[model samples]
Target: MNIAVIGLGLIGGSLIRALAARGHRVLGFDADPAVRATARDAAARMPATGRWQVTATIRDVAADADLVVLAVPLPALHNVLDALVASGFHGLITDVTSVKGQVRDAVATRLTGAANPVAGFVGGHPMAGREASGFASGDAALFTGCAWVLCLDEGVGLDDWLTVAELITELGARVVPATTEEHDRAVAAISHVPHLMASALAANAAEDLLALTLAAGSFRDGTRVAATRPELVAAMCGGNAEAVKLALAHVIQRLDGAMQALEERDPVKAVRAWAAEGHATRGAWPPDPGRPEEVPAHVETLLRLGRAGGWVTTVAPDRRTVTGFLPVSNA
Candidate 1:
């Protein structure tokens, strides 16, 4: 495929390497001259047979491209879409933004004219990233064994979705289909809220320099995400503010319960049980080996029940049953 990747940051640069390594011609573009230069240097070192270059302008990158991946920051996505539309790009388009709702809306609004840049647009968020940014941090292996979420809007055709999914799967990531709203809510609970919690924990601990100095494994691991770029964190959390707020509220309620339990005459039992629950939950995270779970025959029914605020139980291939909580109602 003749692919163009906008924003030669970690995700974009990595995609260039991965796609080119898989023998796809890749043209990279970045607004920043330095980033483009960095990408040029990096592309030179790849051993793929496919042609690779760094385009001087977005039009040069988008022209004659079979697919274009927007790996820019969340806030800049819409503008990039506008530029692509203006440049007359009519290829398949997808993005690596964390938030999907805004990006979906932007694509629908901006890429609609007769000469619009996109034949189809799918909102994508690779559940893989580093705290680091830029082309220098690019690694083709970054997305290996990771979950890549794809949000196909109503306008996107099945063939377009398959093409995008095939490219992502070729890069060694499991492709998971999700609605924009579902993707936002899931990421809020799993990624956004945790990032805020890490930031908050780090900030609170900063007040006591001596205590921070003595902080070991737990503190280091817990607060690791706090070191992510503030702008990226702000965009992610702010873009999904409502979902993040709900996740945070649930966390606060849990923490309040833990605090109340700590005040009991014998707090160990209460605290231990709470901690055990989390430990068990974390331990059960399914191992990812580049394949997604099989969809059940009654998947749509299960999803409808979940959206209607019902508790869901999944019976394993064996007789074991796994129960999980669902939102009382869709947000």
Candidate 2:
């Protein structure tokens, strides 16, 4: 496939490497010249077998491509799609935006105008990333062993869906279908809300140097994702407001129950019951009655972060449960 990848950041760079490795021609485009340079330099870090190209303008890069993978920030997706439509470029379009409902609505409004109707736009979110951002930090293997969600519309043909699935599969990911509403709700509960909690916990802990000094693995582990790129997170939360609000409400309910348990001073049994129930809810996850695959490993981590307000794990691979914090949630 001839593919044009916009954004050239973590997700885009990783996709470039994956597509090129599979012998597909990939053209990279980014607003920042430095990022374009970084994408070119990535070939040395993660060498690819097929030809790769980079450009500054989205039009030049996407003009003749068979597929366009928009890996830009959530807010930028609609504008780019509008430009693509205006330029009379039609292709199978997909995106790596975290929140899909808003993107879907935006495309419906902008690309489906009487002037140009978008016939092939699919929303996707690769449930894989790191605290690091930008092209420099993107790893070609970032999506490896991860789950990638693709929200398909009836307009998208099976061949187009399979093309995107094959690209993701070559990147070492399994593809799952979700509706825009389903994708937004799932990400709000699993991804966006947890990021807020991580940032809050980390901020509270940052106040005292002495406390931070005494902080061992627990504090470090708990706050690890707090280091995520703040701007991107902020945009994601703002874009998916209602769903994230619902997720936060759910989190508050769990926290309220834990607080009630603590107030009664029956910490032992109370915490145990809380952990058990929370773990069970997560353990039985996938909860997506449609996806046949098991929940990914990071799902447990996200659940742990949401339930405990910080990272806490005790169960080891040796099969023994530790006495202190909590057993690792099926890690």
Top candidate on TM-score is 1
Candidate 2 lDDT tens digits, 142-249: 887566776655555544555565567567674555567767888898889988998988899777999988988977877777888788789989999999999999
The true-versus-predicted C-alpha distance at residue 111 of model 2, in Å, is 1.8
lDDT of 2 at 285: 57
* Model 1 TM-score, all chains together: 0.85
Compared with the true structure, all predictions reach lDDT values of: 0.76, 0.72
What residue pairs are clashing in model 2?
Answer: 315-327, 315-328
Q: Largest lDDT belongs to which candidate? A: 1
lDDT comparing candidate 1 with the true structure? 0.76
Q: Could you tell me every candidate's TM-score relative to the true structure?
A: 0.85, 0.79
